[model samples]
Every structure is written in C-alpha cells, then in structure tokens.
Target: MNPQFEELQKRMNHIGNLNNYLEDLLAKIPGNLLSGKQQAKLMDVLLDDSDLTSLLEGLKDPRPPRFVLVGRTGVGKSSLINAMSGRYLAEVSDVEIGTEEARRFTYESDGQVYFEVIDTRDIGESEAFTKDADAEAELAAVVKAFRPDAILFLQKATERAHSDIDVESAKKMMLSAGYGLPMVGIITHVDELNPSRIKDPADYPPGKLALMEDKKGQLRRIFKEQKVPVDAIIPVSSYIEWSQDPDDLSEVERGELTIGFDGRYGIEELLDFLEQSIDIRAAIHLGMTIRIHKISERIALRFIKVFSTLAATVALSPIIATDIAVLLSLQTVLLMIIAYLSGRDLAFKTARELLVSLGGIGATGFTLRMIAQQGSKFANLILPGAGSAISASIASGGTYAIGKAAVAYYLKGVPEEELNKVVKNARDEFDRGLE
Candidate 1:
C-alpha cells in the first residue's frame, strides 16, 4: 500500500479508538452533569462508521445550514447576521425597505462554506403586502423555495409593542415553511432599552439586567399569545459589544456603526440554543462555518472543568500507582475531548503523542517528587496520616495545566517548541500553586 494511504489507515484506527473511549467515558459521567441528549450528540459524530475523509468532507458540504430571517424592516436582521458571523457579510440598511427579495448570504472561512442565511424582505411592510393575496403568495413562494432549517423572528426590544400584523406575519412565515420547523424568537436592538447603554455586559447593573429580563419575558408572552411555536425567545444587541473601535467616527459616518467586533451580546447564547435545538450534524456545520473563537474557547473551558473534577476524584485512590494510572487515563481522555471541541482534526494517536511530549504518565515519578516538594504548602488541607488531599490537589492542578497546554497547542495552534515551554511553565506554576 502507498505510504500516505498507510498513514491514513493508521490515523483512522486511532480515531476509532478515540471514539470508543469517548463513548465509554461519557457513559460513566452522571446524566445530571451532561444531559443524555447532549452526550448522544457528542457521540453521534464518533459512532458513525464513516471514514475520517468522508467526515471532513461533510464539514465542507455544499448544503450550507440555512436560516430564514423573518421580521419587518429595521428589526436588525442584517445586523444580527453580521454579529453572529463576526463579519460584515450582510448589507445593513437603515431604510425601512429592507431586502426586497429573498437574498441569500453565505458565510465562509478559508474558502469553505459554513452556513447560509436567506434574508427576506420585511414580512409585513404595509397593509397592502399583508392583506393583498398576490403579495402574500409571492412571499410564501419565496420562503418555500429556500427551505430553511430554522427561522429567526426578529422584533425590536425598544419598540415595546407587537402589532397584530407583526404577529400574523410571523405566523404566516412559520406556516408557509411547514409546521414543526425550529423557530427562534429574537428581540434585537436590546441595548436601546432602559439604562440606554452598557459597556461591560459581563457586569450588567442590576437595573439593566432586570430590564433585559423584562424585555425577554414580554417577547415570550407575545409569542405565546400569537401562538407562534418558537423553540426559544432570546434578546440580543448587535452593537452592545463592538469588536472594532466602538466609537469609530468613520464607521458611524457610513451608517455602519453597528457592524464591528466585540459589539455582540447574547449571540453566544443564541448559538448555544441553535446547537441544542438543531440536528447534531447541522450544529457541527454551523460551528465550523462561523468559526467563533469565543464559543470554541468556552466549550474547551467547560470540558476542562469536567475533567479537572474527575482527576481530583481519581487522585483519592490509596495506592500511588492506582492514582497515577487513573489520572493518566483521565488526562488522556480529557485531551481528546478538548481536541474535538477545539475543532481540530486530530487523531487519538496524535493526541496521545502530544500528551507524551508534555511529559505524560511516563514522568509521573518526577511529578510525584514535584508534588512532594510542594506538599508542605498544602499541609493544612492534608489530614494527619492521610495523603489523599494532597494527591487530589496535585491531580487537579496538574490536570488543569495539562488542559490549558492542550488548548494552546490544538486550538490556538501554538508551535510545538513554544508549546513545550508553555507546558513546562504551566507545570511549574501548578507545583508552586501560583506562589
């Protein structure tokens, strides 16, 4: 066999092993920690019999994940899309006559299609469009042709009002797309609500938070009243957190102030909702398409916590060898999961190789010595005649360091030589406990 083909076969076998390991590990995690549905989806990509090449090709699949934006003009549909995609892919217009036709906006990165958005004209621009038989038929025909996977019914939070025509238009779009399709109710322009503006979203003032929640509640009530079968109603602001100069007067002059970096709010939550609400394959496709580094980092950190906890628990083993064995296994599995979450096409063997390069289980004796030398600092936590607490501390800290190293290597694409330095620095910090 060709050497390249032989290497491919080896990689495939390694991936198979990794998949089986993940299935077993996820099975062991309590259902409360990870819902059965989420576990199943995580395992779905692995459980399939498809080859690595085919799975990757599927990522670049031409059938982009389609989303239909349903709302009247000035509801911030274009702004919302631009925010979610982290780029100026949509044409944002201030005029009330937004997107007269079914405009398809495709988001791609590195020359690969990730997802598509069908931006339709304002559903109910006037009484003539809403009540006229011909206009309604034309709108329905356009939506039917696009066949979106989901629909975003956008309403402005500052408007504080929902006309019957607005509700009816939303219902009409849902019906035209065929019932049971996932529809998410989005209240855009949320920053314009009371409190007027906020700089740090993470530290929202109590009044601001309350007002945001109130707006969400109001939208939900309207959706319920309108009989719109929406999966979720979330409030978002496209300009709350700008990625570029928030006060860039040039962009303001162009009437594109809302289109920038770091201006996104609740967009991550919106993405999370879509991931859980849509098909697993579609979710993966979207993740690849959008390439949202923040969301990827968030997922990586979450898995880090999960594995860090497991490592701490495993460290409680009475026998040193048993503790070392379990910690190594747990760390190995943790790295694999992180690699996957980071969207890296890494094989199990490659992950293990990377772990070994970071001193892995082979250097556990050295790790033990390092822990012992630093054990005095944690003596207060370690009970007399019991070393388990110290072991737990070392395991947790080391596992955390290992997780961070893996994220830097796989996700951040840090060079191997530089990454080795990062790992060494991390281990030293863990040994010293930030002292």
Candidate 2:
C-alpha cells in the first residue's frame, strides 16, 4: 500500500463505526419529497456493515471504478491507464498470452492501488478462438467475476483496422453488462492525427481539431447505426511523458490538470464522465483518487455537501429540535468522516471536542436556526408556502455553517478565532443566496 492511504487506514482504525444512530436519525427525519420506499432504500444502504468496511478497504488498496475495457488488443490500453494514473502503472508488452481470460489488471503505485479494469481478451483475432472458444459464454463468466462500473470501447485515432469486428464484439459484451449500462466510445492517440508536429493538445491546431471531431463523429455514427447504446463519445490522447523523478516536477506540472507532455488531453474530461456515469456509491471512492494527501480534502468537501443537503431536504416543516438533532447527527457523522479523510483520528470524541472548541451558541448554528424556525412558525400562520421555503433556507444555511466551519478547522486548519467568522459568513452567504 502507498504510505499515504495506508496511513489513512491506520487513522481510520482508531474510529468506531456506529451507524445505528445515523440510521435512527434518518428514520425519524420527516422526508418532504422522499417516499417510504426511498427512505427504506437509504436505510438498507447504512444497515450493511460489510459494505462500509469494504469502502475503506477500497481506498487503502485503491481498487475501485472497476471498468471493463471493450476493444481488441492495442489501442493504447496500457497507456490510457498509465496516463490516467500519472504513473507507469501498465507496461506495454509486445508478447500476447494467446488466452481469453478477461483478466483484471490492477494499477498500483507505491503499493496503493488506484483502480482496476477487466482487460478483455481480443475476439476474432484468432479464427480458431472465435469459432470454437464460446466467447459469449466466456464474457458472461467475466461479468460475474468483475462487475464493471463503466464500459469503454476503444479505437485508435489514426487506424481503423478491424473496426467492424471491435464494434460487433462490443455489442456481444453488452449482454454481460446488461442493458442500460453506460458505454463510452473512446478515440485514442489523437496526438497521432494530422499535423503530428502538434504534440500538446492545448495547442492543437485547427487541422488536429477537425480530424478529432471527424473521428468522434464517425464513432458516434457507427454506434448509432449498429443500434448499440453509447452514452458519450470522447476523443483523447492519453500519452504523458513524465520525468523519472516524480518530485522533480515543476509547479505547473504538479497541478492536477497539467501533465508533463503537452499532447495529453481529454483524459480529465473522460474521468469526469466516468464519475458522473458510474454508480453514486462508486463515485464516492473517487475522493481518494489521484494525489493521496489532497484526496482527503476532496472527500471532506464532498462530505460537507452531502450531509448539508441531506439535512436540509429531510428536515420537517415544523423545524423542531428533532430536526436539529437529525442535522446534528448527520453533521457529526460528516465530521467523523472528514476527520478520517484528513488522516486524523476518526472518532465521535474528536468531532465533539472540535465542536466544543467552536463554542456553543447552540453549537454555533443551532440557536440561530431555532430562532429562524420560530419566526417561520409564525409566518406559517399567515402564508405556509413562504414559511416552508424559509424553513428550508434556514435549515440548509445552519447545517452548511457547521460543516464549513469544521472543514476550515479540520481540512484547512484555520485558527480557532477564525472558525466563528467562517460559520457566520457561510451561513449568511448561503441564506442570502436562497433569498
């Protein structure tokens, strides 16, 4: 395991998982929009203890975003993964195993894994394998072995050899994935397009852009003609020439979007597409992706958003202390997760102590939220439509305040004196936006 995320797991070990309180709070919260079925679905997610442990294990080992690569041999599969990883995770090998196992290729650096993919065996390459191997049944077995979060059909930006065979094979694989699965068409090696001198994608000339658009259009047209479902068509150049020494990288190169080679483009966009198209629970693992230390901050930022939104949306119109307790419990869990993400001890005591440090003007937000709730109650006597909106506004703002304050403290390490200002500013800013 990478020293960074391995350390994260060590820190997480200190925290206890008490999902019961969260489940109870969620069950009690009045859902204005959620039906009984949705509530039950949410509870079922929390009830499974093993899933929670597996999530943390995924971060530590870095095995998630299980993608199924659907294409013939070559098309820069190794380079695509390596480019996405910003490391030499996959070695391009010339020798073929002559096997059709659909093996899982795991990419790990410094012992921490980032992701895994089902590298499917090339079909129709050998007439003997295609005619006699029962490729369809093999693919079904693959589906059981490695359930993919996304499926990608790959083609070289410069070559079109066996495109028909690749597309047909992709259609057959869809049976294994089941219908409605997100399938993306990838046009790789865009740097090899016309005007090969244009290496950096940032400086892609008009000729290169036209060629890329042309390829994307062709891919899209083919998929449509075949009646094969594809969610997105992306043309990407996944080649990145990194320095042998990672620490020797420049400031610009160190940035997430910037790569060592100029021709690298469309990868970040593809990753964004995967995050959006993948399962919501799977997407959560994305927080720990890329830079290990900063992964925590990303996770913490998302936590604040998720907890605040859940608290606000589920809050009852009456906005009683029960509503506050719901918010508090969710916020507390949010803090615990945030703390764990920051590589600190993940415990209720840690959150409680930090919260105590924030001072209790009803824990810096509750009292103000209650005051607003009381006013909204009176407003309900007159115009309930306006009062309901006001209640939502206040609940959202209050929880957001607590969350932001904790983020500043835990993630940004903002000083104690500054936390109150953050709380007040966040609450005021959110409330104003709602207004």
Candidate 3:
C-alpha cells in the first residue's frame, strides 16, 4: 500500500475505534440495553422489513458471487475481471479446484469479499483432455457442489472459434445447478472489430455496431439451439488503459495506453443487466458490491429504515432513561452507518462537530418538539403502555431525522449549516405524520 493510503487507513481505524468507544460508553451510562432478547428483536425487525430483507441476507452470506466464466482460451475473461475490479488481479482459473486461488479475481472492500469471478479453465480450444475429466464435465461437477450466481459466456466478436462448446458447457453447468441459471453472452474484444481506429464502444460507427449485433445474434442462436437460457448478450472491451499502477500519476502519464480501450465501455450495462435479471439475493449483493448508481440510494434507504426500526424497538424498554440513552447511542451509530453507506469517508470529528452544532450531542439542547418528546418519558410510570408507545415514537422520529440529515450531508452535499434545517424539516414531517 502507498504510504498516504496506509496513513488514511490508520486514521480511519482510529476514528472508528473512537466511535466504537463512544457507543460502548453510551450503552453503559444508563445500563446494558443490548440484551440477547433485544438483539433478537432487532434482527426480527430487520428481517421483517421488505426493503432490508435481502440486504441483511446478502450481508450475512460472506461468500461472494461465484460467476462461472465459460469460454475458450483468449476470450478476454481475465482482462474483463481486471476491468471490473479496476486493478490487476490475475488470470482466470477453474474456480472449482482449490489450485491457483491467487489467480482468481475477487472483488473485495475493506477486507470483505463482495464478488468473485470463477473463470473456468480455458475450454473448447479444440477439444481438450484435462486432469480427472473433460472441461465441461469438470465444470458440471463443480456447479453441482456449489452453484454459481450466474454464468458469463465470453466470446470475441472478431474471432469466435468453437462457439458450440461454449453453449454446451453452459448447458451442462445449468443442469448441474439443478435450477436453470441465468447466462450472459459477452462479446469481448469489440475494439478490434470496428474500423479499428475507433475503440470506444459508445462511439462505434454503424459498421462496428452492426458487426456486434451479428455476433450477438450468432451467439444467441447457438444458445437457443442448444436449449440454454440466456438473459442478455452484451459487447464489451476489457482492455485496461494503464499498464502501470494508476496511483503513480507520473508513471501513468508516461506509460498509459490511451486508445479505444482507454476507458472500459459496456461494463456498466452488463452489470445493470445482471442486477436487474438475477435473483433478489444476488442482485442486492451485486448492487452493494459495485455500488451501482442506479440502486445505491435504495440500498442506503434500506439501511436507514433498519437503524430506525432498531431504534424504535430498542426504546421499548420500560426504563425511560435507559430508552433515551439507547436512542442517543443508536442515532449516533445511524449517522455513522449512513455516512458510510453514502460512500463518504467522513471524519468522525467533523460529524461530531456538526452534531454538536445541531444540539445533537451538546449543551445547545433539544428543540421544542424534542423537549416535549422527552417530557413524555415521565408518562412511563403513570401511563405504562402508552408511555412506551410515545417513547418508541420519539426514538424512531429522532433516529429518522438524524438518518435523513446524515444522508443529506454525505450524499446530497447539503451544507452543514443547512443540515439542521433538514433535520428540523424531517422532524416536523414525522410529527405531522403522527395521528
């Protein structure tokens, strides 16, 4: 790692540790609120909410997507994985076997694996006899053991050799998965198919576009003939522009290969197709992994809802002071999570400063509505059940306000001074929402 990046990572860890310490202190000031039963309640609420159901399911499944890449040698699968990851990972491998694990590309973030490209051994070069069994048979056996999220059928538009075997292998893998698996036909090396001079797929002239269409048609017909189901066939150029580490701007400035493949094209379209076509679980994983612009806001909203619900249930405890303390702690954590999900590398101190200014964790104190909300806590002794309902409502509203304000700050670029107004507005809305 570069020194600068390593330093940034260290700072981030330190801030996270501080926030964790703060949360721990808050949890203890009033008492232990996160009992086993309360934790179960949070989980139940998260699972019950439809928006967060799939996200929670995906987060727990540590195993990344197994994308079975089926194609002959030189089909550009290795380059495609690098393009997707935006780095030099390695060559493709037969993902079934444990050998050559380093060569397999897995999309990871902060040490958590998000997605993996299980590139099958280059198959159908002419008919290959490999160790243990034929290429297709081995792939079938692997799929039988662990089903892939989807299959990527790769072929070069300019040179598609032994296309029949590509279709056959996908067929066998689909059968092995028991349930039919969605397959995407990828036409690689599209930059070479054109008038050659123009490399960007978006800028491809009618000639190149028509040629890609013909290739798609050919692959589609082959898969259809073999009775294999295919979701979409896309044309892409997987050539990475930089041969050197991109961080070294000087090296990249001198050694960059700026051409048709300078900026990879059609990858976004392919990912969008996968996110829209795959099962809910895989789609959530892909959306989170790539941070797809199309669905990122939805994912963020899911987390917001999760934290808000957690705040509500955790506030249901009979002790009013405990409920309030827990809500404050939960709201702080909610802000941290919202900032993170918004893809912002925020300094915890910056957030703390903003919260203090808004009277979130400072002597500036609560707004009128908040004072009333807090005043309702006294009802817990007199009203009991009704007081609990009011407490839960207050906690939920406060959490939602903090969550929306954090989203505005991190995602919408709302100015810090203006965030208080956003929080005020959200709180007002929640107040109005109460019957």
Candidate 4:
C-alpha cells in the first residue's frame, strides 16, 4: 500500500474509534436523565460529516427569529420584553393605550441581531376594535409583513374579570393572517395578585402559588374555549421590585434605598418554554439575540453534569491511553454543546483546534503526567484493591472546569488570551478538588 494511503487509513480508524467511544458514552447515561431522542440529536450534531463552515454559516444566518406580541393595552407587553431581554428594549407606559402603529424592536448583541419583536397595538382592547373590519385588515397586513415564528398573548394576572375581546382578537389574527405559529399565553403582573406584595416569587405562600396556578388554568381554559391552540400559559412577574441607583445616592446612604431588590421571577421558566417550543435553529437565534445569562447558565450546567458522568464512567478502568482519549472526546463534545447553548457558532474545526490547544488526545509526556497526577490523587478514595477512583474525581473536576471556561468564552465573550487564563484557573481548581 502507498504510504499516504496507509496514513489516511490510520486517520480514518482514529476517527472511527472516537465516534464509537462517544456513542457508548452517550448510551451509558440514563435515558430519563437525557432522553434517547435528545441523545440521538446530540450525536447527530456532534458526529455530522457536513461542511463545518457551511453548518456554522447556516446557524448564524442573518435572519432574526421573530415573535409577535398580541395583547390588550395595559397588559405589560413592553415590560415582558424588557424582562426577557434583560434590557429596556420596549417602552413601558402607564397610559392605557400603547403605540398605535405596529412597532418592531430588534435586539442586538455584539453587533449581531438575534431577535425581532413585533408589538401589535390596537388589538383586543375594545369590542369596537375587534368588530372594525379596518382594524382587522390592518392587523392582517402587519402579521403578513412580520412573519412571526411564535405568538405571545399577554394578559394581566390581577384582573379577575374576563372578557371575550382577547379571544376574538386572537382568532382574527390567526385566521386573517393564516399564521400557524405556536401561541403562548403570558399572564403578567403576577406579583400584583398578592395582597402583601411579596418580593421573592419563590417565597410566595402556598395559597399564592395555588392562585397563580388557578390563574394559568383560567387563561388556558379561555383559550381552549375559543378553540385557539396555545402551547403553554406561563405566569410571570415582569417587575416585582425595583431599587434606586446606588451611585445616585450619597456614599453613606448608597445602599439604603436599594436594600431588598429581588429581580424578576418566572422569566427564566418562560424563556425556557419558549426555547423548547421552537426548533433548535430558532432557539439558537433567540438565545444569541437575548442576553439571558440565567437560562444559559442553567443549560450549560445540565450539559456539564451529563458529560461529567460519561467521563467518569470511561475513567473507571484507568487505561492511560483509552482514558485520556475518552476524556478528551467527552470534553470536546461538551464544549461544542456549551457553545451551541450559549448561542455561539462553533465549527467542528474550531472545537478540534481548541482541544489541540488544551492537550491533544494522542498521549504526550505532559498529558501523561497530568493524568497520572489526577489519578494518583483519587486512588486512595477507592476501596482496597479496587480500580482507581481518582479518575472519577478528575473527570468531574475537569468537566466542571471546562463548563465554566466555556461559559466565559461563549456567553461572556472573554478574549482568547483571557479565556486561556480562565481555563487554567478552572483546571487548577479541579486538581485541588475545589470545583
């Protein structure tokens, strides 16, 4: 055989080995923990043979994910946007009527547009508006142009009295525009329902929680009664508490005015539901456009746990060559998933480059020393004559470090130089068992 052909065959074997290892690792994880369907999807994404650049380009397509906000006036549509985006993108007003013309709000981060929010005004507030053919026609025109991927129907939670105007308006919008998009019912002003006005949403009394559930049920029932299909009805308090700027106050009294400001609650749940309801492409677009660190952190942590378990399983037997290979593969796949969750476009080549920079899978002297040191540290933890438990500890610690580093790199946009430092710090922490 030609030398070049032999080398090519060797590389193919290596690739095949890695792919099989990853599949086995994924299978070891419980299906309930990571559903088989989700596992399969992740495998497909990680092992795809498609052009990496083309895949990334498609992920980063300029077309923003669009959402249409449909609600009556004074329902806190603007506030909802502000809470979800963590920016005052929409104008909150005390006036009963919102902007007359349909307005588009684009959310951009680091010069890249992520989402387009369309606020449809003058709908569902009055019976006359719903009855007016002209108003209906105008709404149809707006919906046609916006081409929204989802519909968010906002309703004030405190309002006990119900009306058919909202239902009628939704029917008209869905019918005239022929939008088959998923509809989500958002019950805003949930905090207002509590007479005592609790600042912490999680601290709500059992009765309060029950009331919230009941309200959500009511909203769902109303939509069902109107024959309008809704994906979910989430209750959220856009702004339960606010604090004054510390800088604006005197130095001595700076913290006085802002003593107990608990941020918005239920927003994360709403965002999660929205992300899951849409396809992966739209979810990625939304995540990139919206700066929701909490949601991203939650997802990244979950992936870290999943991958860490897989890594530990591979390390249990402690074959230097196989252990390092499996660990590296797990970490590489982990970083890729973290990047995706963070709404960052990471090509396969970039992931491979990162792995090489950290430490290539082919065992070098440096890599061997590091693995031995990690294994030695936890060797005592295993029972007498048992295989080294050091692998398990190192696996968990390294995975935790990788997760933190990935979060900083992809979500926080840390520079490459600084990101390396972050990775180093994480590794040190893991070695010390502090992670």
Candidate 5:
C-alpha cells in the first residue's frame, strides 16, 4: 500500500514539474508578451519558424508519406500502424495497455519514400485514466514533434457508434492539436461479417455498415454533425482467417489488402489514400493546424484573465469602497501586471503558438469581466466588514475555479452545437465567393 501511494505521489510530482516547465517556457515568448508592432515582428518570425517551409526542409524523407493512426483505445490504432508497417512496429492486442506514450515507427522503401507513423494513447481511455486537457496536451506534443502528412482515424466498423463519446473525444483532441490536417476514416473489423452472408439488411445494423447509398448518407450526416469530415470511409477487417471471394459481387473488396501474412480489413484503400492523396512534403497544412490550436489557446487565455481578475479583487478588498472609480483603475493596472507576471516564464516559441488567433485577446477580456462580476456578486452575499478578506478570498477562489472549468466544458461541448454553424458559414461564404 505504501509503495503504491509513493508511486502515485511520484507520478503527480512528475506531472507537476512538466506543467511548471511548460508555463515557464511559454512566459519568455515575446509573441505572447509584447503588443502592437513588436508582437507582430516576433510573431512573423515565430510563425515562419513553425510554418511548413521551415519544418519540411528538416524532414529526412522530403516527400516521404507520413501518417498518424489516431483513434480510441481498444479501437486497434496500434494494430493499424503495425499492419501498415508490415512488421511489429507498434504493439497490438485486444487489451488496451501497450501504448502509454507516443510511438513513432519509420518505414522506408528504397531511399526515396519514407513513412513515419506516430501512435498516441490518449484517445478513448476511461475518465479515470485520462483527462480531456491532458490528452489535448499530449497530442499537441505529438504534433509539435512530428507533424504528420495525414491522419488515419481508425474506427471499428463492427462496433456501433452507440454514443457520442468516441466522436466527441476525437473532435477535441484533433481540433485542439492537429487542427486542419486532412483525415480519412478506416472502418475496421468489417471482415467479421458471416461467410455465407448476402443481402439480409438485418444481419448488419444501420450505423455499423454504410453499405447502401442511404447508409452512406446516414454515416455522412452524423459525421457532419460531429464536425469530422472524412475524405473517405473505407470498411475493413483485420481478422486472421478472414477471406473474400475475389470474383464475388460483394461491394466490399477482398484479397485486395493483406495484413500479418493473412487477409485483413481496410488495407488497400488506406494505402492507396496515403500514396495518392497525401502530399507528404507540403507545409501548407502546418499553418492551418496552427489556426485550430489558436482557437483553444484563445479560450485558455480567457480563463487566465478570469483567474487574475478574481485574484486582484480579493487582494484589493479594503480600497474598493473608498473610491469605486479609483479601485477599478487600480484593478486594471493590477490585471496588466498580473498578465506579465503570469506570462513571464513563457518561451518565445510557445507564446507564438498560443497567440496565433486574433480573437484570443478580446475573448479573454470578456471572460475576465464575467468572472469579476460573478466574484462581486458572491462577495455581496457575504456580510460586509470584519472577516471580509477571508470571505472574499473564498468567493474569488470559487469563481476562478468554476470559470476555468466552464471554459474547458465549452470547448468540449460547443463544437457539437457549432458544427451546423460552421457548415452554414462555409456555404454562405462560398455563395459570396461565387457572386
């Protein structure tokens, strides 16, 4: 018991150190600290460094096809990576404990075409084992380390999209980290269909197999609702003994793809997509991905403002009644100082990453005001005078905690509501373009 407790403590300490380092590193970045033209100059340099042109030059295989297999735990993400590599590059199993960190496997055919596949473990794990924010950070690290050419979102076709959990989980991770990178879906485990199967619609459930045109429409409709656009959805089976008659009229192709010296699912289309569609050498996707990260960064920055504002209101309680106008000015001045102090440890690179979105500043300011007002309301509920500092501090702390949680919740939840909004906006803009 003591050993277990000690191990848990060690893990907590490690995470704490990592978080502290990130905060400190992000503080020194001039793009996050400076304002006006100075910030612009620093941003230009930072973006140039992070952009496609700079990173692509360093790639060992300039135009090598690289793909990251991203999906929920137990969804066979590692298996897909290993299958594609034609070797045991990534550990595979029915159980979900193998991948706890990012696994990178590089394959080269001849000297020209190189394929690097990255596997991340933060997707689709239980709440007890993973947090949404931690998963986002881990994926961001994966993106920063190896910006893949394309993403293969592997989902088990045999498994129904029973709940919104899987789609929502992937949405937050990708949008928060990978952003605008192109993605294709491989609905695996389709080989599980019975050998004698023909045209019994009841054999395959509605959502499981998008066999017919209407089924494809249904699948696309939901995928659209989830804000996940797939370039293609290829159904597959990775079963060991799975086989199909080559001459059969089954819409699902067989013997076209093989895995582990045996026939398996979705291998052909997956390979063809990578070979034909993905431009493994381009940098344009990196710039677009940065924009997606900016949306989350802006939301994070807003929560930070709320925290600092509440802190100031608590610290300056005594002078509030003396002059409301003067106190408000003092609060503003303090907020600026707090922003600097909090951001002091940020790195030049990390800050630029956080400030890519133009909307972050205004959103942060608005969120801070909301937090401050909530804190004031709570303070009014407390009896004025005597132990005011103690009461106000508690109120302020509660408000800050709730405010941050709310922002996190919105980032996870609002995208579902905003999916239709995004599609509508795209169509409206397209019509304007046609005009």
Candidate 6:
C-alpha cells in the first residue's frame, strides 16, 4: 500500500477508537425525567406555570444543525465534505464508499454559525428483507437526534438523472426520515463531458440539450410528485478540476473556480446557494454529526462481527463433536443463501461465500480423512486418511479471510463500481505502458 494511504488507515483507526470510547460513555447517561403521571407532579412543584413551561421547553429544545448527505453509493459526498471543510477529515477514494454510518464533521466559524455534515451509507441498497425497515429506522434515528434543516440529495450527472435507482431510493428515504423537510438536489460529475465540443449547457447540440432538459424535468417532477420541496439543484464536479493549477491564471483572472471536469461553472452556482440558503450554524452542526456518526458506525460494525464470531464459536463447539457434519453443512448452506441474496453488497456476499466454501470443503475432507484412519473400513469408504484435520483447518481459514475483508470494507467504505473501475483503469494503463 502507498505510505500516505497506510497513514490514513492508521488515523481512521485512531479516530474510530476515540469515538467508540465516547459512545460507551454516552450510553451510560440516564433517560429523560418526564414520565407518565410524574409530569403533572413535577409541574405542580414548579415555581409558576410560565417558569415550568420555560424549563420544559429548554429541556426539550432540539439539538444542533446536521446536513445529511444522501445519494447513491459512489457519489462525491465525501469529496464535497472534504472540499467544504478545507481538510481531509473524511476518507476519499475512487474505489471506496467512505461514509458507512451517519457521521458528523463540524465546521465552526467565529460566533454561533456552525455546520455539521452527516454522512450515511446507501441505505436504499440494503437487503430486500431489511431495506424498508432499516431505512425507516435509520430515518427515524436521524430525525429524532438532529432535525436537519435541509438534506442534500446527490446523484451523478453523467449517469441518468431520472430512472436512476439511487435517486428514487433517496427521495423515498428522505420522506420517510423527515416528512416535508426542505431539500436540495446536487448532481455530481457534470465536468465529465468533452469540453472542446461543448463547454456549457447552451453550447450542447440541440438533441443532447433536449435530452438533458427532459431528464431535469423528470427529476423535478419526481420530487414534486413525492412532495419533497426542492430548494435549488446544483451540479458539481470536485476531482475533475484536480489537474488544474490556479496560480497560472491569465490576465482576465476568470470569474469561475475550476476544479476540473468543467465543474466550476455549475458548482460555483451551487456553492452560492449553499452559502445563502443554509444557516452556517446548521451546516457546522451537521458536519460534527457526520464525523461522530462515521466513528460510531465503524466501531459498532466491528463489534458486531467480533460478537457474532464468539457466539458462533461457542454455539458450534458442543455440537461439532456429536454432529459436525450436520452443523457444518447447515452453516455452509446458510452462508451461500445469504451470499446469493446480497446482490449489490459484494463485500458481504463474497465473505459469506468464502465461509460457505471453506466449511464445505473442510468438513468433507475431515470426514474422509477420519474414515481413512479406520484402516480397512476407511479405505472401503474412500477417505483422504490423515488429511482430514488439515483440510478442516484450511477450510476454517475462509471464515477468517472473509471476516477480515468485511471489516476492511466497512472501515474504508469501498464500493463495488469504484473497485471495478480502478481495476479496469489499471489494466488499461499497464497495457499502454507495455506498448
């Protein structure tokens, strides 16, 4: 691995550790005091009705501002956060989905104005059996903890504007989480078009322009249909302008800030709206929530794996001796079934398959080897003799491999499309260099 990447990984680990400690401490805090009939009793003991009302209102006051970054898996949510904060607090990569949980990254400026960026995973892509429930629960949690002033629904402009599965999923999720909440649409990757042919929307060929308008219209209608009040639609491209150097500007000193991919034109407009519409305090609060959520989700996911492994080990121990074959077979079958069901979640699915394959081969070999050890009877049964234990051990190693991969996947927020693209690009680059 690159040294910089390795350093980043280490830092992320440290941050996660700190967040876990905080969560543990917070969990210990007591619940609210107002309960059932006690509410009336407390009110009676208050100095006066006005004073009691003020106290209750103060206690029930809403938390800080949190901006939820909702969109498809590989959209530039993390990149945008990094750019806005002017730092590398959130991890960024072409191959990874960095925000696995609802994390907060806060931006505090001067007095009371604050912005908190909240990052959440692609809840829409959750398992079919759990997607609705999971999404609903996730929405409820977000709404309850921090009543976000606005949600930034993101999508790739290069990708279809309408009929995009992620866009649809996002609209549904937002409504479920915060009914009638104000929202803004952000289209990413607009800088990807060929600049020489057509630099702006006006310059595009009539046919393509028409198509673009239709898409925008469709998207607008969808949101309107869903009753999600749209504030402003901003198209942005962050990394497309990475290749440019601002120091070499001409005498004209362009009005636009080019980030690459011709995104400066569109994103500048969006930034203007963000500055004007979103309260700075709310943005900072959302950013903090995003940072916190990232830390908690990562720690919680790791804990889940550790707990599950320990439970599986203990649960399987007693049955292994008496019914190793049956138990092993069942475990393998369950994993395979789960792997098949997890269509888009490649990391999880792959891990499940690895476990299934390992258990299957291990148990088969162990049984055969044991039977082989029985001399004539084993030979008659056609077993691998002393190789049974070795095979079983090797097979069990699959569990470890998958577990490690899953942990890394969640920690890094790597996505399937980005992984494939990187691999493909590397292959093409290698071929070119060889030539």
Residue pairs in collision within model 1: 114-289, 241-262, 241-263, 242-261, 242-262, 242-263, 243-261, 243-262, 244-261
Q: Write the per-residue lDDT of candidate 5 for residues 1-435, one digit (tens) a residue.
A: 134323322322332242343334334434433434433332232234332233223221234355666666677764565455443331222223234545666543222122456665455556643455565566666565566666776666545563245556555545645456667766655645443242232345654354533334555566788878668766655444223333462322431333333545456556655543555233212111222322232323333444334443444444333222222222232222222322232234432332122112353332343344345544545655533454344333333433333233334443333333332343244336436
Deviation of model 3 at 341, angstroms: 3.7
Error of 3 at 123 (Å): 3.7
What's the TM-score of each model vs. the native? 0.54, 0.69, 0.56, 0.53, 0.38, 0.38
Count of clashes, each model: 9, 4, 1, 0, 18, 40
Q: Model-by-model lDDT, in order?
A: 0.62, 0.65, 0.63, 0.61, 0.43, 0.43
Compose the digit string of candidate 2's lDDT tens values, residues 1-435: 556655654544333233544453354445653456555544443344354444444433444677778776778887787777666653222233233646667665544556767777556455654566566576676665567787888999888777777777777677676655788899999998988877887788997899999998888878887888889999888867664444675433433233456457898788778765776445545545554555556545555665566655545445443344444555666666676556564455567566555544663456655566646766666765566566666666666777788788878889978987887888788778765
Q: What TM value does model 5 have?
A: 0.38
Tell me the lDDT of candidate 3. Answer: 0.63
Candidate 1 C-alpha error for residue 291, in Å: 3.5
- Compare the candidates by lDDT and give the number of the best one: 2
C-alpha lDDT of candidate 5 relative to the true structure: 0.43
Clashes of 4: 0
Q: Lowest lDDT 10-mer window, candidate 1?
A: 90-99
lDDT, model 5, position 369:
37
Residue-wise C-alpha lDDT for candidate 3, range 291-388, written one tens digit per residue: 44434455456567777777777767666454554455556555665565555544545555555565554333444445555667688778777766
Report the lDDT of model 4 for residue 120.
68
Across 286-388, the per-residue lDDT of candidate 1 in tens digits comes to: 6644644443554456556656666666666554443454466567667876676554555545665676667634445335543562453344455542666
Query: Which candidate number has the best TM-score?
Result: 2
List runs of model 6 lying over 4 Å from the truth. Answer: 1-65, 82-115, 127-135, 161-168, 176-180, 194-212, 243-263, 283-435
Off by over 4 Å in 3: 1-44, 47-54, 60-64, 92-118, 126-138, 160-164, 243-261, 273-336, 340-408, 416-435
Model 6 compared with the native: what TM-score? 0.38
